[model samples]
Target: MVDGAIAGAVGSAALNVVSYLDVAVRARPTSSTPEETVGRLAGLAHVDLGPEDRAANRRSGLGAVLGYAVGIGAGAVLGALAGTRRMPLAVGTALLGGATMATTDASLAVLRISDPRTWRRSDWMADLVPHLAYGMAAAATLNRLRPPSARCG
Candidate 1:
């Protein structure tokens, strides 16, 4: 559990770094999907967040925080699973990336917030690259932490 938590933190940091770098390089606006998803969920749950102006800002902040939480949580879960039976580095990385992407994309689709099918090639690349980085970092960290005996197939 401790190893997983540590790996998750590292993975979350990697994801954040990649995201910031992408923004710096492209000067692109951050995606609003998170905020929109959060808002939709809130509405469904009938959870009032107070004043309209404050609520909007709060939701946006919460959305970003939630994204980080998901990344960390996913890493932890993956780490725990890998502890029992380790996967090859490449396979683990790909699975982690896919898992992370699916979590976000699934939530958006379920809430009718965004359709990935409509995304431009550039948008897809933007989302994919950082996630791949996150997966690699998390998987590598977990792999390194595993006992040598456990690492072998």
Candidate 2:
């Protein structure tokens, strides 16, 4: 569990780095989906976030934190699933990336945060690339931390 959490943290950092790099290269404004998602969830939950200024700030922080939670939780699940089994890197990456992407996209769709159906190619690219980076990093890290006793040989 600990190993998986660490791996997930590493992957989350990788995802952020790739995302920021994209932002730098494209000169596009950062996506507000995270904040919006938080807002929507809060509303549905009947949780008040305080004044508008403070709420916005809280939303931003919560948005980023929620991302990390998802990444870490996903990693832990992957770790549990791969216990004592040596999954190939390509397969592991695909599984991890697909899982994370599906999780985020599904939540957004359910919450009406963003519709994938209307997203352009560029938007999809933006989402895909960072997630791939995340998968690659998390999968590699998890494998690196695998217990020797668990190796398939």
Model 1 stretches with alpha carbons more than 4 Å out? 84-86
Candidate number achieving the greatest lDDT relative to the actual structure = 2
What is the C-alpha lDDT profile of model 2 across 77-139, one tens digit per residue? 888877755667787789888889999999999999899989999999999999989999998
TM value for model 1 = 0.90
User: How close to the true structure is residue 25 of candidate 1, measured as C-alpha lDDT?
Assistant: 95
Model 1: ten consecutive residues of lowest lDDT: 78-87
Worst ten-residue run, lDDT, model 2?
144-153
RMSD to the hidden true structure, all candidates: 1.6, 1.5
TM-score of each: 0.90, 0.95
